[model samples]
Target: MSADDSSATARDSLDGGAATLTTRRLRYLGAALATLVALLHLLDPNHGLLELFALLYANPRVLVFDPRPAAFVVSATALLVGVSLSRNAPNRRPYYVAGIVVALTYVVGYLAWHLTGHGGFLPGREPLLHGVAPVANVVRHLTSDPWAAASMASELGLIATLVALLRRE
Candidate 1:
């Protein structure tokens, strides 16, 4: 092949490779952001659950009265993002696995807490009568006490996973 032709082919190949690498990096970044958000939720320290509840209230469409569904959505999204980004990255499987595990655990725990009536992570009393908004009333009664323990566990797990991802070679 002529030198010019060979050079052009090489440039095109280089450009394609660079584009692929950039896409992969962006995906990884998205995964990292999702993981960070989860970690923030786990680490938040609020004694009354008021702050947490307010935060949830802010996004009523997502959190509503029942947080399990919302949490599930967040966790599921995180898992998908983590998995997609880590597909070809080194030591990424473990991070992705950890993230998925944590997300699932959070959802399961939320559901269990609601079923048991042991009180939720947030604090408030369930309205006497179930009105049009059942989830809101349920969420109101969720005392922060339950969250203290659960949050501690979640915080530890998320921190460990975050560290692993950061240190992955």
Candidate 2:
């Protein structure tokens, strides 16, 4: 293999430090996962770019209270931080930590908002009674809520890959 190719693959630090896929490949996977998460948020059916557009169309002032824009901002920032961490060495731990934190935040935030209340679209709505069953909530998100399923899956993937990358340090 070429020098660059050889260096990129190195010994994977994860999975019992097994000689598996190249570290470079793992990094690529991490980046891809991050991109997926960002895209998922960008295209979120309820709280995505389209929703933002609609909010703006309906009433500019409403944007202040809309969560869609905030989601977009956070997603974009996570993507940037994930990419930055995977790009080079030295002081990368921070980036990995930030990326992980962001992913965790999204996952936790989703569960809290939905599980606790009858969350709704822009202008927001809260759950009146109580949260959903954890098992049922996950199942619904995985099966019925297409956008949510995609986002959650990607966020989980991002977390895994980032952790793998971080271990390489």
Candidate 3:
């Protein structure tokens, strides 16, 4: 259009290039949050990568049996996939929706695992219906453990960022 119109469009944050720039910035934020969640899961002092490192230090072959690390690896991989999809996929809605659901599952799963009597074991473990409540134990654990709390918060932040990206798209 005219020079004046071009100048007005350029100045308007919601217009054309400005709007694209805003979307790009949002993508970057989402990517960073996703990456943070992944790193926290891997490198948190509480467990996983740190423990794995210890195991490696002692004897690489003597790695103890712990399924939790596998779970973290899977979760981190899914988050990384989401980050990739957000940037490059042509039709991202299907993947984005799946990613949102996966993220939600992780958050809810963490709560459920802690709130259930058998925090570690599956299926057969009975619920903690007697004595101290499961919920209380989880709350205490989260409050007392800064690393766990930070990891949970990062997961939440990642979820929110994914939701924002979905809405923007």
What global local distance difference test value does model 3 have? Answer: 0.68
Segments in model 2 whose C-alpha atoms lie over 4 Å from true places: 1-21, 60-66, 81-90, 119-138
Clashes of 3: 0
Candidate 3 ranges with C-alpha deviation above 4 Å: 1-16, 50-66, 118-131
Clash pairs (backbone) in predicted model 3: none
Please provide TM-scores, in order, for all candidate models, with all chains considered together: 0.34, 0.70, 0.70
Segments of candidate 1 deviating more than 4 angstroms? 1-26, 47-89, 118-169
Q: Candidate 1 has what TM-score?
A: 0.34
Residue-by-residue lDDT tens digits, candidate 3, 1-169: 5564454456654454765576568778778877888787777564567666676687665433344565666777777777786677655556657766766776787787777753444644556634667788678768988887887887787678668767655
**Residue pairs of candidate 2 with colliding backbone atoms:** 9-22, 115-131, 117-127, 118-127
**Candidates sorted by TM-score, descending order?**
2, 3, 1
For model 1, the local distance difference test gives: 0.51
lDDT of 2 by residue, 1-169 (tens): 5554354356343354454545557767877887788777876777777777787788877755546565676676667666865586545567777788889988887776566543443345544332567556656666877778778888998898889877765
Alpha carbon lDDT of residue 129, candidate 2? 31
Tell me the tens digit of each residue's lDDT in model 1 across 58-141. 775534445544454465456556656667654454655566466557545644554445333445525332342445544654
Mind sharing the TM-score for model 2?
Answer: 0.70
